[model samples]
Target: MPRTAPAVCSAVHKTDPDRPRRAADGLNLCRGCLKGMHRNLSDLPWLHAEVVTSMPTTRATGSAPVSGSRTPGLPVNLRAGELHSQMGHDLRTIAGWVAKDRGIHLPVDGRVGSVCAWLAKHVNWLAASQYAADVRGVLTELVGRAWAVIDPDRRPMEVGPCVELVDSTPCDGMLWASVLDVGDPRPSKIWCDGCELELTPEQWYRFGRRYEARRRMSA
Candidate 1:
């Protein structure tokens, strides 16, 4: 015999008997419905999309880009807003400094508001942390998870790509962009134009060989 489903989510489990339980709340939700909810709430197009739809439309009107427009769109549901407010207040109490430093904004929208729900459940643990690193990690993890939901369409990082530096310096680590190529050479970080200037002859040759190997492997 099938186990009785919670009245709150009976319809949810009705659709899919095997829907994942998203929280400690014991409420089981249909996986398809959860994905649909995620799609509705987490699709913050403005952040990921470079080209704004309003740009050309506004240009046609002979006006400057709309400056006062609020950020793309927020989740319009009342429950989502309440959840965000609740999370904000709780975070401020336990991890106020970390939240402020990290700009902890809870992005919630649909039925699967599971991320927000999870954070709320763990607020007490996050607050009782003594180390700043642990607190920061929790906050960062929450934010990163939110982003993962918001922008699900991520391209894999390619071998030949530039990653930004953690800090900035006048002669910063190779002027801040880690120019990734075939050879995974260490950053000389000194102000220089070429490998000949940045590295010793032996270092350059050894690094070149490694780079070639990396290229072949990747290929």
Candidate 2:
């Protein structure tokens, strides 16, 4: 059976009108141009291989926007003073209590940084027993209240009726204590306390082991 040649488009012929017509060979190319066309097609595999090798495989996912770029779901305007005012109020409350207890009046400006530094330097020194007890009481009350404000589950632990003095020369007392839910480790220290009976080394060792055991059990 004689096979009829397929119809060729004028645009393809215009490019190579002198080329002779032949069977399509399923490649859509005339026989005359088929050799050149197959050569180009053969180069395509290598061309694709080079392109794939050059192209990067890994691309970064979504990243933080550069400065000044529009950010979705973020507040467009923030009031600087409003944020500071809230923080200042908390600090002023702490400062006010410290001033009243120590009998050293300081401006309760509601900012902790400067006021705490000033109080540390300027507060009047009292006898160790009076000072230690006063400081401990103040801290206990303030910390308990502060934690209660933020934490729904905060409960005050039953601290000892005894104050354990660690250093006597300068009267530094260390109490092995834990906050119920706040999870602050390392015992709180009350300084300048006039006391003779410091917790012995054995007591510290036992306390440390118990504390560790409780922590592991909780975990």
Candidate 3:
């Protein structure tokens, strides 16, 4: 019998339809995606703590210096708080699902670190399960959100100028795409500063083709 082609990865980040798929032991996710998901789960707890420490009030750990003026310091970072809360919730929610199915008991205290540890131990199994894509998406999203708080200035790759048409003219915005770190899920962000145009992964190929055609026409 002829060998069947490997099934494409169903992970959310695998949006590049032209990319080749690799076999993954009959798992829903490819090996690279599975590894990235595992790494994200392992890093979630650390990222959660780092995001908390990134908050200005948390870092100060004391009352502000008296400046002899009635003024408010930086407003509390509600976004950071939300990220921290959501991280714990996501970790525990996934862990709870796994625990219920595997007959494993979660820690009574519901510590995020303990939950992360538990998830780390079972990530491989989780990657092979039917819910692999969902698990990967949740873990990757959590890690990405935490990274935004911890390192908002992550380096970007220049992707030439914006090729988006505005009233039959090309927008003059410079485009930059997010650079992915090792073990990061495939990055799909491509944005233009001048026009504030953002391209989804599905549009990247067509955008590139149009950009090259425009360039050749000018030359």
Candidate 4:
């Protein structure tokens, strides 16, 4: 038999049955609703358990459960101001030193609004700790470095061709060059300026052999 829906007070009459229903007075909520609410709460310490775990041990305060004892993994519905306060406190205590050392003067007002927004833009929140660490390392290297001063002409070590390849070979005299624009997970398109020909993988290999032979004969 289908169970009858629970009676809701007039104030909460507009709420859907599936969503978490709470008493108008904020007293007791349905068990299912409470669970859903708990999961959805962004302030829950468990949501950040992975982050907390990767933090340096020296930052530990009192050794109790990092989130709290009463609701170890439970979520807490925190207001925007409260969330900002917590983040500000953490960044000031932990990241302030590094920022100062790098001559990036973070505000001392204990409100991390600007800092948090900056971090959100650069770092992927869902990435693993090791990935985040690598990103931090890169950022640290960029400290005090002017973006405009960095050489834009330099190319990446790994470049790909724009077309498919069947086979290839290397010779001492011929350079294995790829198109400047192609990227990985895509085929490479290579052409030889000397022959004014678009060289397939096999043809490129032959060109390399001929170039090497000519070089050896000249020597």
Per-residue accuracy of model 2 over 59-119 as CA lDDT, tens digit each: 1124333346454543321222232343345445545665777677777442344544444
Clashes of each: 2, 2, 0, 6
**Model 4 collision count:** 6
Instruction: For model 1, name the residue pairs that clash.
Output: 174-189, 183-211
On residues 179-199, what C-alpha lDDT tens digit does candidate 3 reach at each position? 667786655567664343667
TM-scores for the candidates: 0.23, 0.26, 0.58, 0.19
For model 1, state the Cα shift of residue 14 in Å: 36
Report the C-alpha lDDT of model 1 over 100-144, residue by residue, as the tens digit.
545775434322334434345444333332332243333433333
- Candidates 1 and 2, the one with greater lDDT: 2
**On a 0 to 100 scale, what is the lDDT of residue 20 in model 3?**
44
Candidate 4: regions farther than 4 A off: 1-85, 118-219
Which lDDT value does model 1 have at 3?
A: 43
Q: What is the lDDT of every predicted structure here?
A: 0.32, 0.34, 0.67, 0.32
Q: Tens digits of per-residue lDDT for model 4 on 12-126? A: 1112423333322222322222222222222123223323333322223234444534543324322322433444455454345445444565555533444443344322221
